[model samples]
Target: MANLILYKQTDLSDRMTVNRSHQANGGMSLFRTTSWKRSFVSSWLLRLSMFLLLSLPNSEGKAIWTAHLNITFQVGNRIISELGETGVFGNHSPLEKVAGMVVLPEGWNQNACNPMTNFSRPETTESWLALIERGGCTFTHKIKVAAERGANGVIIYNYPGTGNKVFPMSHQGTGNVVAVMIGNLKGMELFHLIQKGVHVTIIIEVGRRHIPWLNHHIMSLFTFMAATVACFFLYCARRPRMPSTATRRRRQIKADIKKAIGELELRVLKEGDKEIDPNGDSCVVCFDIYKPKDTVRILTCKHLFHKACIDPWLLAHRTCPMCKCDILKA
Candidate 1:
């Protein structure tokens, strides 16, 4: 019996140990699953937020319309004006109207590859402009050099690779001057005109061009807002009616206004009336003196005006014109 009792006690101890181990393992597994779920949810939320932020319209750095370049010259007996491709305006550049005679560097008149590092001023000595090709330095550098030499504006033609496609430019820190770029083809055309001794005048004018993506987003937002407003109105129309306090107050106010208007006193202006001096009192609407035998209406606030004038004014304004007293409140 003593051996059997010892055996039974050992068996009970082993069973309790196994049970405790299984419970601990189950708790650890549950904790690991919870941790993974939390991590996954947090990562998903972060990614969603980033996507939303990037998807919104960029209010800063809005795209602007490009300026137009108008080039004019005399072809034999007739005058010719051709529009050239325009590029971006420089930052802090003046948008005011700039008109001047086009000039090229002394040795660079016929050469498209002219670096224009040393440009010659025009012989006329009036407000003249510089024509340079895009190469050898930054846009700001070329513009700044030309501006220092007293050029009213600087026109840079695109490189050969850009063909006839004009693009906007950023020349920050450059002096206040009008700077524009043209396509390679337009530049060559103007260059040849100058080479042929044809005097050309170019005009830079500010113009508007719509950005495709911005217009699309604006239309989409407008449509969405209109639909939302329409849906809200529809919901209100379909919603069950309840007499709220505001609605009841508005109705009471309307009724009071009608009652006040019905009880308003009417009088006729005469020469000897003590209430009104026809010569002194003028109709505010017509700015005319009140005449004898004229009919008028008196408001609750004791302000008087011609019936034809005050009736229409009260119907529209719902208050005394001079005193601004509310008939509904009275």
Candidate 2:
């Protein structure tokens, strides 16, 4: 009876300890979850800020603008015409449509590097466009020289050996001037025709517009969002699994059985003890008679058995060997 009371007290103590441990673990889990949420929010905000910064317009404060050029030249008795969006406007050029006869500088050098470069204009042609080579001076200086020479518009070609490559030129302080750049190959074709004194006329009109930096911003934002979503799913998939209700109950029962086993009374058989008698019932586990100095255990049902044998038996069965009494209920 005393052993039964001690077993019950031990079981109850174990139950309280498990409950306190669970509560403490729950509190710590809540704190860690809260901290993780805060960190996730902060990380998202930082990514959003970077995305916004990347989405901003280019620092040059201007987007690339393309120009469509229509050219008509008289070859023999037939007039040849061609049209394509093969030109980019200068950064400071005015967005306007202009048309005129194409002309070159007065001297052998096609680049209007000299501030006093003169344009040979036909007496009958009221408006003419200056065709200049790109080199030897700043774009601003060339455009200014052409504009001051009574040219209606300016068209600068790219460097030699560069076939159809063109970019928007940075020509500040040349206000309201209609300046455009063509590829070196295209420029050479026109230059030869104009040099041969073939009458060439061109019509320049605004074409498509493009923002080069916008694509990078969009791709970066998509990558960041994808990574964040993948991380969230990975975390959820790897989180620790909680114990089921049935599993918890099974664990608690095992703990109770161990505690009861530890609380059972142990005794040593002596020479005069009845347990040492030859006529006494043998241990059900080992089928052996108890002898002097043999260790035995007393169960709550008043049944006895060898301590070594009953300890393993109670752990598996949790009951007395003879009467089948449950130690936990006793």
59-104 per-residue lDDT for model 1 (tens digits)? 2344544667888899899999877335545445666568789887
lDDT (tens digit, per residue) of candidate 2 on 1-330: 122223334543555465456545543443454556455545554544544453453334457788999999999999899999979888899999999999999887999999989998788998889999999999999999999988889999989976767878889999887999988899999999998999999999999886544544555568678877876775676454655578889899999999998888889989998778788889999999998999999998888899999998998999887888999999
Q: Which ten residues in a row have the lowest lDDT in candidate 1?
A: 1-10
- TM-score (all chains, Cα) for each model: 0.45, 0.53
List ranges where model 2 is wrong by over 4 Å. Answer: 1-61, 222-330
Please estimate how well model 2 matches the true structure, expressed as its whole-model Cα lDDT. Answer: 0.81
Output the worst ten-in-a-row residue range by lDDT, candidate 2. 1-10
